[model samples]
Target: MQPSGTPSRRVSAFDIALALGGLLFIFLSAQNAGPAIAALRADGVQGTFTAQRLDCVEHPGHEQCSWVGDFRSDDAAVVREGIGFYGSERSTFTPGATSPAFDTGRLGHVYGPGGSNEWVIIAALLLVGLALTLRPLLRLRRPPRTPAPPPVPEHLP
Candidate 1:
């Protein structure tokens, strides 16, 4: 390297941390992405969820609700207990009511006849993770900037 004025790009601990955090996000999102997509596609055990109870959590402005129940496959071959019916609302079901559902083997929750839009959030997380992971590496690839020519000195008469 004959050039002495070029600024060097060094990978700092912060960059490593960012990359590691990004990998964690990517891993967590990927773990759920497949099941979420499958649930959206209704590609899993077709079943009916029997509402045993409605669980609600009150928030500042509104309440969130989920129907906790049992899911039984149409053929009666598969049955799961105490699983949540995803996207169930207060008016959607009452005690002892049943709705068609799909179980993509995701624990504790199943999809209803109408698939959910969870994949969108998962995709966003993946994009954010990818950006975080690549940002620093990309910075390192750019040509080093030449140091601004030493600030022009004022000439005195």
Candidate 2:
């Protein structure tokens, strides 16, 4: 509270730290966006065909969904069990049965925080962090909107 009866405002250290953390993702995503996109578009053949929908058994702390099938291509040979992560929506494979390959080529796999979608998610986080950070700063700068005191009427003689 101020002497003028209005509340004072300041951006807290905790808020600043959180904002910085969130904003960092944006920069990080930008750094990875180019490479992730390129790898996804590169000459990769569908690694799995005649695929089967593999869901992790009802277990906590597991992703629980992916495709498992054999890898077949001119560059590769011999049927091998392959599993894909976080690609359920793109998969056409059904549980316990084989299906045509949904992917045209093998995926260019990256270690972590890779793929175009992850970039989008990071960007969203950055924007949210920016908003969270900026809101308090803006409030501090804005003048308090307290109403003016009413004028007193003069007494009649």
Candidate 3:
């Protein structure tokens, strides 16, 4: 607790660090959110992804997989090579097979026709960041209390 008569709580290095970290998280969320939202809405260049191969990585208990492919827009205006199809699974596509996809200018990956839940994670990050940033400042807004008066002594024995 702060001593009486102090105007406000002193800000600490930890508080500053927390706020900075929160800002970093907020910045990261903002940076990725646009592309993620666009991809989730399929609001970009409509294209077809031709699967060239399946790239799989084995973890301790499971395997993560994606289809590496080339994308060509329906209008033939946009074409991307060596891009991975987002949310692809092991059996999602066969070699040389094509699937409808959307390119929202996110590096290295294109979204599929079925939308993704990526925005949920980004929203959560943003909320947590806001909370962290505000928690330290909230203490400073509270008014300080005056010291209480001493109790009177007994008058009679």
Number of the predicted model whose lDDT against the real structure is largest: 1
All predictions: root-mean-square deviation over Cα? 2.2, 6.9, 3.3
**What would you estimate as the lDDT of candidate 1?**
0.90
Which wins on TM-score, candidate 2 or candidate 3?
3
Candidate ranking (lDDT, best to worst): 1, 3, 2
Model 2 misplacement above 4 A: 1-8, 17-21, 24-53, 57-64, 69-82, 89-91, 94-120, 150-157
User: Model 3 Cα RMSD, Å?
Assistant: 3.3
Flag clash pairs in model 3.
none
Q: Estimate each model's TM-score.
A: 0.90, 0.46, 0.85
30-64 per-residue lDDT for model 3 (tens digits):
99999889977879899899999999999999999
Clash count per candidate: 0, 6, 0
Q: Which stretches of candidate 1 lie over 4 Å from their true place?
A: 1-3, 151-157
- lDDT (10s digit) by residue, model 2, range 1-157: 8897986777788767866775676566666555445444532343334455565555777445555555544356534456453344334356655433323222422111122355456557567766765766776789877868899999999
Write the residue-wise lDDT of candidate 1 on 30-145 in tens digits: 99999989977889999899999999999999999989999999999999999999888888899999889989999889999888888998998899899889989998999987
Candidate 2 — which pairs collide?
Answer: 44-105, 44-106, 45-105, 45-106, 46-104, 46-105
Q: Quote model 2's TM-score.
A: 0.46
